[model samples]
Target: MTAPVAGTTPDRPLVRTWLYAVAIATGLAGAAAVVHQVTGRFWGDLGAYRAGAVAAATGDGNLYQASHLTPDGIALGFTYPPFAALLMQPLAVLSMPVAVATWTVVSVVALVAVIGLVLHQVGTPDRHRPATTIGALVAALPVFAVAGHLQVGQVGLILMWLVLADLVGGRHRRWHGLGVGIAAGIKLTPLVFIGLLVLTGRWRAAATALGGFAATVAVGFAWRPADSAWFFSGGLLDTDRVTGDPRTVLNQSLAGAVTRVADDPTPGFVWWVLAAVAAVAGLAVAVGQHRRGDVLTAVLVCAATGLLVSPVSWHHHWVWWVPALLLLGGHAWRHRHRTATATTVGVWVVLVASTSWVLAAPGGWDLHFTGLGLVYSNLYVLLGVAGIGVAGWRLRQPTGPPRPATVDTLSGSQP
Candidate 1:
């Protein structure tokens, strides 16, 4: 007799797609109501309009022009190459609320699409459903918290997608560089992936990324010489003014966390040490796994490492980790036994479910809720630490022998 299966696999992909559609829709609807309920929301919305207005009214470069006055301008404002504003400038003409709302939709869509693409790449057909479902579920919580910024045409989702693309398209080295270039041009942090490519001996990728970086800078400066000067010399170099704002609580990065922990001590040295160590360790892991050709693993490793090691990751930024969670969760569910996928899934589910409630709660809730939020936050941190530990453990374990490839009857490629 055939061996009995443990769990039934339903039509997971369709179910997953449907679940996410509902979850994201619900999040948007809820946020709209919350924004409407806040008495001072109009004022806040107006403020956003004014910023974009100031940016659009004065010139194409107003927001950027302001950044040039500061040192970190190069790194802030999406820290992307100048081309990012190409699309955003038009939004300036619309009412602030309209512009932001439209952009949030785009970001949400991009995030979902990217995660879906990654899931398809790494998962078996049966696994896709759960992976996508979990992705949507995790995304709803973090994306809602960071909804305010998404409305402003921020590129976090886009950047995260591009990075994931790099890992997924590893077999196509050119595509890897292209994704990295696009991401770096949109945001500087993704350039860190260049370091990873180099460590992996993908010299071509490094060269392509570097060339793209230089080319964009050259073209951006060529297009607007004055703005470029301000952006490069002053804006790119300074982080103090860019990061000084107290409202950037969502960053929740190491630097931001330190700031939260103590109002005074700068702790600059500690933050640098931590970031450097993370980058080095993470790059090492990615390079070691280079031969595996698992794009999902590379992307997750990079993102998780960045969040854990960065000094100022906010909860919204956690949205980037959704794919990582899904990948881990899907892998676990697929294996279900030998791997710690179930444990990983449980950890992520608890963290995400609790986080949404705490984040969405209006201030002055009961002490019990407040206490629970604190406990949950602590739990979130611990899980993050534990995740890094687990990833490190997985990395140390030898990569299992390659699975036998099943020939795809349609494409002739190995599935």
Candidate 2:
């Protein structure tokens, strides 16, 4: 079955009203919990970001060299680019509770905005779009995560929103691709989007992205020369900044899986080989979707590629799956695969609902896992790999040629 055109589905006002009510209740409750946790985590990721900015702004010490200990004894330092520290300088100015509260609200709004953006790109019509989006978010509760991230104060959703806006909403604009470059400056994962720009034949945008990224790098070097040099030179290689140990269950990257399976802390040749293969395969899937004229799916796969190939894809980074499944379920629903879609949604709910337990599994013991423990630990990575395979398999061997792939099929007004 072909995908449904925008006007094909009828809307139900009662359904929309109920979903809106549920969404508001659930979102506020979730935000409250997230804010509470963030407030309690004094030396957590927000702390790192704030501390890093205060260091850079107040000249306390080297941003790269500084480290703070958590209550549990894990040593974390400011690991993001110098540009990020500068950008986050506001965090250093606000009181901790106010900063955490404000950040939580901003993150929640960003995630909802990202969801709305994805739904728009997926061609969900205005009549039923709101219900469909809130329904999906409520169903995928963790991904909804209204006011905060499960990982506490991560900027991944904001970056996702920035990239999606550039790709889908700004497709026709000359300033396209600039958001992605700035995002990469904040966190390097979105850098893969520049390559997606190149492969999808947006060469000028690619150049603009590269130029924007270069400008950020130049700014970093200008403001914090020594820290910038250390980071750009070798500090980036130290995975401990973001991902302490590759073998840890929280690291759901291809290299992480390989290291856990191979029992190597330093994960050398095999990890590289696996990463290379996954990157190539995932990018191939993305390019194929582009050729098929589905820029939404193409951009998402490129995002997935970044997650899969990075040295350590923290479990929270897996939130990208929310928009992904929205698109995928749309395809399946239009195809009338009701049972398959239900099964997919059920699996997602079960896995994510148990995330608190799974995340807590690494608490008492060393990170080594075996047997089903390995599967339990790497479930997200496995699911991501499976998602790439399914996406590739769903495409026909040949569709209409590169039909000027654009993300504007039924995107309403920009979110």
Candidate 3:
């Protein structure tokens, strides 16, 4: 870990007290926001999930066919697997308000845990007061996106935490890939992480992830054979059916950007070519980082790749940018690279300024891909590309092999 910044030692107690106060204040504010949201007409995205769960539980209709309107009456479809509906069945039993409140609290906690895990992965655990303070401040840069997802009751943050835990958790445990498998079962994007494990040469872990995913499919099949057949056979590949307009400013993936500019009968071919290039380049960087024993960096690189390659990576899905920013800032800080640090901070400013809270404001979508709107819409994809560049550059530099990280160290938690 890097040394504490000058003068921080004498003020350690005061700083700790201030941090505790800030944490409590933030939590209270978030809780109050949740309360207001529940009382008001905003159920955000939870309506879709809850409606699907209700359909599944009652067997009243096709789970995939169920759609719920927002308070504004915009119909939202349930795009997840049948198994996801099954998983959400318990929440379906609760009243809407209760379910919303419960989900908000759980998502908030998951967000906090993700911040902690990211900080630890970047070598800034709470035990290091100065580093922890810096991490907290840096972590705040992505709060806008996180809070946006929370307001919508989106599952992005929870999915992010699951992937982080699977990468950094339970190194000694046999089922290291179980979390990734389960998350993938709920939403298919996480299946990329299994490829990541394979690329990093964790063959056993890769096999375990594959097995777990198979188990999830089997369970879904047993529970709803027709739905499973429909989804697995073709429905899963139909991005247009699952997600909304690909040209929407909210989608930050390569396909989204291409869709905004192209009028081809099959623009998907362009997307596939771009995705192939990104996957090869990004995975190469991740594999290099892993070989160098920087597992955290490798994991993050793979995550960014997943977001970039996915057909419709919503602005909320870029929540992984939180950790990516922290890791880059930490690297720059530790190396005392002023230019790099400035660039890192500049990226954070850009991302935060372009958050869904800002870009998705009333009438903002009307702006489309005009001028600065283009930059804002494609920010996450650009960031992912930049990450790949950084990884490649780092791989070329000369350095000794990193010290072997223990299972506990990889887990990012105290034993």
Candidate 4:
């Protein structure tokens, strides 16, 4: 028998094509499922946004005071910043059906873009067909969660893309922090990236983020002074008003878990303590990854930390896990040790499976967890904790002679 030729894999391209075909097919199916589930109905959250936008554009009642109802008759109110309402003014010009359809399409596109971004950042080198194919397949694991967000016209996917774009483009752009700032203006969660930038010694980017955020605030104040004052003076701090109940099964933040288990009026204190510890440990790991030239990993760590520390993190907000899973899976696929590979891939499998299950389950703030429900409700927070633990473990491992710390733009030859 002839020996296999070295440095050649003839079937690799064929395998890659097959993988791409499967991923595309699966994504289309997921989109179909979302449409079937939603059936072109008005989205509850998007209704609130639309109402706010209409109010802002018409100079009617205060945007914050505008009351909207979901198709199901649930009372919904605008909870985002004044700038978010201003940004939605264009949608207000359209009829309800048209606005919902347009927003849904945009959201679906953003979801696809997020998947492509993760694959590009964590997949094998551009020259490695097999690795890239595997990355695409891994990227599909979170499609169900993405579809859930799309069905409701949730903004999580767009926010995820904004953060990823900033991280991916920051190395090449002078004003890298602008995207993050704009995203934070729309929703405060993305402000966490600014802290990550500061921790990573990207002071210029941090300043840019602050400036962009300030500009948004200024625009809001100039355009609608009373609404801007309402948000900044009190609305922003009223998590209960913006997010409903922390005990909601959909809220997977550390605070949510605490709220579920603790009945004390002072549970907020406990959450604060836990959040502080998580922030310190998670940010420390992020700093270490940055110093090791693994900027992507560091960013994921910080993103996960943000989810955990937030007062309310809906299940869709955990979309950051898409990139987290890809990064971990890629590392596992490249490792030399079978045991390590199995363990890493096992974690990815567990997380992906659990996320799908949770998204499918009936969830509400009034619901209480028992038995498996506890695990299901706390899945994302546990994943965040596990990610931080993995970072700490990596820090302890013996390292080769340190190469000069340089950003891993996540663009290079295959490992």
If scored against the real structure, what TM-score would every candidate get? Answer: 0.72, 0.85, 0.85, 0.81
List residue ranges in candidate 4 displaced over 4 A. Answer: 1-42, 127-144, 263-266, 336-366, 398-415
Worst 10 residues of 2 by lDDT: 402-411
Candidate 4: the clashing residue pairs are: none
**Candidate number with the higher TM-score (1 or 4):** 4
Local accuracy of candidate 4 as per-residue lDDT tens digits, 1-415 = 0112458653444444445545664565455445535664546677788888999998987888886775555677889889999888987888655666667656655554555455455544446634564455445545545545655557887887777777753555777899889999999889988988898889988999899999999999999999999899988887666565567667778888887777322346789899999999998998888777677778889988988998888767777766776666666665655776776667656655654544433534344667676777687788789888888788877653432222222222121
Q: In candidate 2, what are the lDDT values of residues 300-330, reduced to their tens digit?
A: 8888788888888877677777777777676
**Candidates arranged by lDDT, highest first:** 2, 3, 4, 1
lDDT of 2 at 371: 91
Clashes of each: 22, 0, 0, 0
lDDT of 1: 0.54
Q: lDDT scores for all predictions? A: 0.54, 0.72, 0.72, 0.70
- Worst ten-residue run, lDDT, model 3? 403-412
For residue 260, give model 1's deviation from the true position in Å: 4.4
Q: Which candidate is the best by TM-score?
A: 2
